[model samples]
Target: MKILIKMKSSLKDIVELIIQEFKTIASSYSILLVLIGGIFIYGLLYNYMYQPNVIRNAPVVVVDKSNSKLSREYTRLIDAAPQVEVYGTAVDFIAAKELMKENKVAGIIYIPKDFDTRVNRGEESIFITYAVTQAFLYYSSIQEASAGAMLELDDRYRPNMVVFLPAKDVLQIAAATPISVSGTPLYNYTEGYGTYLIPAVIMIIIFQTLMMVISMISGKERESGSIRHFAEQGTTLKRVSRIIISKTFVYCILYSIFGLFLAGLIPIIFQLPNIGNSYEIIMLFIPYLLATCFFGLAGSVFFTDSEAPILMIAFFSVGLVFLSGISYPLELMPWYWQATHFIIPAAPGTLAFVKVNSMGASMADIQTEYITLWIQCAVYFILACLAYQYNIKKAIK
Candidate 1:
């Protein structure tokens, strides 16, 4: 009977602690802004900015020194490509450079005077392309358009030797290339930048915002001396464990709603990729959220004031993006950098979510990331409890 009464008291205390944490978050304007603005406003703003997705008709200035029918036809073909448009012709390389310097074009294409001479002689021909170093999109668009035009030109000039071959052998010879190539893109059919990047960004935003909010709340507790009061409440191992649980519960519930908006509605609204199984996404998210929350709680020990979390965490936003292996492949990263993937919940979470959501991967495909998150959850939860116990002990001193 006495043990039952003790269990009831402990349960009541946990509920009260959870309510108190929620109230603290509600009353703080900074916490509310970071929680609300970072998730909704940032999500909408990023999607809107990248809505155009694909780069098209990037302008290029052509220097056609050959001034022949074939060279003019090549220029026309390049302009017709969807990736780039010829702004105009330049008489020489020097003239094209001036236009590029003026920012009149994204790139310059230089066709040598021998361009038509080489093609007529049935020899290989090459053209030089120059693009601004400021943005890679300009270079990519120019290269794709130029290469496509060159292929068409090559087909037009190549001899039709199949005509001399016997009828049966002609078909075989025509079909017989050393290798066949297909340029079709899988997963990202349109091959847009937004399609490739935004889904990963959504997961990253969830992790970053959750970290900031938890750290800010922890910082506020320390700054306002509220933690000292809480520390005076017996500071038992059991009580410290309950405090950690209460805090994690509040964050997990709030972020679940935020996660639904980010992972569900945002993709539908922006028309980004959303092919993952909803059941699988939820399964992945459960461990991700738990790991991130505890990761934040463990790191919160270092935050000296409410403002400190923002200062420290805001700098890591870009780092997190790169570390997530969205912009680059994880396998190619340096050994030391690759090791970080194991330490940061966002790294594995982003990769796993991208696979499931963007690539339509199954749960089995993400077993490594899924298991890593659970391991992090276990490890960080222990660290958070120990951190709070230390804080309470320090307060007693």
Candidate 2:
């Protein structure tokens, strides 16, 4: 009778608690920081990382009118830069243009009949060329890499083209003469702003929604003494466990489907090519999605008023997104920042997306991350179970 009276007294406070917690969550730092950071990342990505370093697979046809060893060396040097590939060696200008018209080659390099003579005489010689404007930035990088390789080869062969190349240009000297680079830029081979940024945004949605929904229910159940009734009624440990587990499973399935559609399927529908195997991407994320749901559920069990869980989630969401390299790549960040990123879930999550969508990677590629996610999931499930069984009773009393 006393317990029933106490319950009636507390019913109004429960409604107030839900409204207050919701209000507090709405104004939390995680929400604010995520919004601000999202804008910052978009601005930074366009202004910085999207700047092309080199074309991935541009076709370059060589016209050796000189038929000299020097022209041959130049051809070889240009072909090795990780961007340019030898389309065809043309006998003359007309043949090269034929290849270009066929779209078999992107650019043509014309070596005049006395190419070596001009260089040996220390005469300024223009290596005439044909490169149409196609994604000017990518073309420019290919041009620069080609030109840089030519000058470098000139130094090695001329042995005097640059007084400082061998001594002053430390990186040039240290790198192997034929040091190579290539871009197997897999998913979103186009690598446009939307293709890259949108996947990360999807991940943000997944992490946020799963944590929010799970926390809302778990926290509400705790403060309302529902957990105590379940415990006191001896609602059977198996059933109590099933309740949270079922909810967690539902959240996981819902967000995983939502994210997969947003990140994986939509890009393909929009014509973003080379977006890896859809099945592989969906399969890989199962463990990660599982980990996040339980991690948030565990947090809910520990938090009484919901304010702390909400705040913690908000902090982690923004912090994790930044650390994940969704906005800016970890490759460009300072060494210390790169080192710190690996510990965060966002790092692994972002990498997984890049691999599945961009790289055409299989299970072998993400084995380490898959194992990590499962291990973390196990840890969270254990903690959640322990908390509900032992800690909730104390908190309620």
The Cα local distance difference test for each model comes to: 0.88, 0.63
**How many clashing residue pairs appear in each of the predictions shown?**
0, 4
RMSD of each: 6.5, 12.2
Query: Which candidate achieves the best TM-score against the true structure?
Result: 1
TM-score of each: 0.76, 0.49
Off by over 4 Å in 2: 1-191, 232-240, 268-274, 315-318, 325-346
Write one digit per residue (lDDT tens) for candidate 1, span 115-168: 988776656798989998655466777888999999988777655434545799
Find the number of clashing residue pairs for candidate 2: 4
Best of the candidates, lDDT: 1
How displaced is residue 370 in candidate 1, in Å?
1.1
Q: What is residue 363's positional error in candidate 2, in angstroms? A: 0.7
Q: Which stretches of candidate 1 lie over 4 Å from their true place?
A: 56-75, 85-180
